[model samples]
Target chain A: MSVSSQDIPTAAISRLVIYLRILEALEAAEISRTSSSDLAERAQVTAFQVRKDLAYFGRFGTRGMGYTVPLLKRELMRVLGLNRTWNVVIMGMGRLGQAVANYPGASDYQFGYVGLFDIDPELVGREIRGLKVQHADELKGFVQTRPVDLGFLAVPPEHAQAAAQTLVSAGIRGILNFAPTMIQPRLIPGSSEVESEWKAVSVENVDFLAGMKRLAFYTLNPHLRPSELKPSELSSTELEA
Target chain B: MSVSSQDIPTAAISRLVIYLRILEALEAAEISRTSSSDLAERAQVTAFQVRKDLAYFGRFGTRGMGYTVPLLKRELMRVLGLNRTWNVVIMGMGRLGQAVANYPGASDYQFGYVGLFDIDPELVGREIRGLKVQHADELKGFVQTRPVDLGFLAVPPEHAQAAAQTLVSAGIRGILNFAPTMIQPRLIPGSSEVESEWKAVSVENVDFLAGMKRLAFYTLNPHLRPSELKPSELSSTELEA
Candidate 1:
């Protein structure tokens, strides 16, 4: 609680997840203690960055022994707000939505799959991965009645904004938007005095197009990787930037 | 070729795509001659960062006038290797694979969907979005006879590494992996005296689990965003870091 969320960089928060993944793997491999340098190597980040990102949350790394795998992993879990189970729903039970619903990693991260939804009538009564596909129209009512901490927008690009609006009205605070379009945090107009206040939510997009665009850049410019560049000119320059 | 890809930061590459999108949207909306500060607000990055990221490619921002719309967009297109169309294939007919095959953003980014391949006998020869699904075994033969710049790996987690190896042996360079697993760079053993060598391929994974984790963090700690934070300390530190 000492460190406000605003105190940490969003990039650091993202890197923390990567660190958590790496630490989890190392812990599974029975590695007890590791240095920031080693962790930096696995994470493709600098030692100073690894240390600085961790330092904001308090000292997880000992001066000499580096970071204890289990201890650091626990700290990251709490920092990432993954210490508790998050009930989630997948809107738009399309192929992508189905894939997300059945994705195996969700359980590992404690994301509980509670509901499946779609706007199409044909998909409404269908069963996907043991959950019945509810109408997209029911989203607000369902969320108001049930506990859904997160929503996954796997709808088509054209339907994305509408789907996001539905989720917002449903009181979804967190959204993992797979739709190609970037969903901005907008004010939802209130109808009455009781609801005139505005609400803003968090949206994280898992855009493979951006990933592919990055791949295209790296593939076309393989020589650009920092490791292959001149040490003095490359290391501190971009890392600091 | 004037700027080595290494000289430009990878983070900048990611931002360039965002800038490209923002610029494209502006172009579509008939806006021209926007400043770095305005671009920064739309892209959610710092004005200095917008300039610094662009400076790596070439000077796009004018001393006071900011950037000309079409010129900057054209330069970014060239720098991102988006000037040419990339022939691509999706190597799975599964739910996620089908969705990727149907993803509309690829065309907007100059990625041409050339082929679809899957290992399932039933899926073979089936037309998905008008492209015939070829057997996975035919990948090497097809690539040898044709040109494929990228591949989308949407196979099950267990088959990801092997599928990636197959794509590599087929000489495909870029891959956007959708499996809920991390595919690392590994030694690929080639058969026979003429082919007894190992090669590496670039992979970008679109893991929603990571996105969801980030969402959970923000949902739990909403005060982190710059707009919500106290105006003082949240400005430059993380942006530079």
Candidate 2:
């Protein structure tokens, strides 16, 4: 059955991560259960919003007892597709790419680094963090051998699109692109003899520059408090921009 | 008096940047004006949402017509505090720090690299991207000499809090922390004091891991869809997560 109209919103996914982290912290502190109000306070949303976001996944939280810490955490992890280990690859062995590839927390969340690739001839075949840096040409071959779930693109803006195409052509889908350029996904129309494949890929862009601009705008406009951002949704007095 | 209730949302600021970039591209292509629908299409939001976001700043579009390209761009830049130059300091000269310090687009956006600092003696006194890296101890002295508008924290997670404290103690109000850990703001009291000065600061955390998590989540749960994200806002049918 198609679930197009019933899909969860991306904003809710982000809030899910926030809730997941908070729940994990509470669990670490030996807290058994938490109310929507507690999650709302840490997440800077509202108790109602928390309930609604969680409702999208399934029934959660008791009538008066709230949600069990470990149960909610497990449910979120399952909904987020974090129930299994995901093999990840990093493209472009530049400084940023290397830093992301070598991040210590990747394993803590079950995101395992399986491969590193770069187009530069010198970087090809080089070993970094115990993973070999394969040439870009071998991407498809590598993907065929290993089930790469995510391709973290850290290439320069000029080469970003091509690197993404490589990942896509190699059958990699989920992309975390840090190239500061937009990449739209669409199926390529083929000739009468060729079949056009559906371009189904999920791209999450981490725009560092935009984040910096937000901080600048908010800090410069101190009179603009965090609680008054929109007409809808619960007000938040968060310290973030 | 109080503009807290009338403050623009941080999300609006982000969309403003998106509009600015799109407008710039259109201007370069000789396009003069655009309808809110056009901006919304490119920005992955509804035309009504576009009008609402822009309305938070000021009136822009003409009656029964679209907004003038250059004028809206200038207005957005001004609203985002991009009209003036922003002095930025990069702390922790690791790979990430070096990459950010030497970023090519900083000058284009009027964000200038004024100072670089790290706790390591080896990194201290090093010149990167023409800006000298000072010891973390020299942060307060450098802030006194330079009017740094943004403190970009790229230090390790363990040292993130101390690095933030240095920036705050140096009177830097705007901070963009890339540290994966949480950095809370508060006053530090000395041994013989009842209370220390309240450290009021604006912090924007750029958690890269969360971005990656979203990418993985959407890729696996393609049925969830990107447009289905926010309950309070317009439903987007665009293909992004």
Itemize residue pairs with steric clashes in candidate 1: A224-B6
Q: lDDT of model 2 at residue B158? A: 76
Clashing pairs in 2: A9-B228, A9-B229, A10-B229
List chain B TM-scores, each candidate.
0.84, 0.83
**lDDT per residue (tens digit) for residues B144-182 in model 1:** 888899989989888987888788778887788888887
lDDT tens digits, residue span A1-241, model 1: 4565456778888898998987776676677666787777667778889888888887776576567778989999998888999999999888778777877678987898889899889899999888899998888888878899999999998888778878877788788899888765532222543122223578888877788878887778766744421212212211211
Question: Which candidate gets the maximum lDDT versus the true structure?
Answer: 1
For model 1, the superposed segments whose C-alpha errors exceed 4 Å read A186-198, A228-241, B186-200, B228-241
What tens digits encode model 2's per-residue C-alpha lDDT throughout A1-241?
1224585667788899989987876687677778888788667677888988888877777777777889989888887777788898899998778777765566777988899999898888889889889888888998988689998998887788778878878888788987777554521233422112123578888777777778778788755636421212222222211
Clashes of 1: 1
Name the TM-score of candidate 1: 0.88
Candidate 1 local lDDT, residue B231: 19
User: For each candidate, what's the DockQ?
Assistant: 0.45, 0.40
User: Given candidate 1, what's the lDDT at residue A73?
Assistant: 92
lDDT score for candidate 1 against the true structure: 0.76
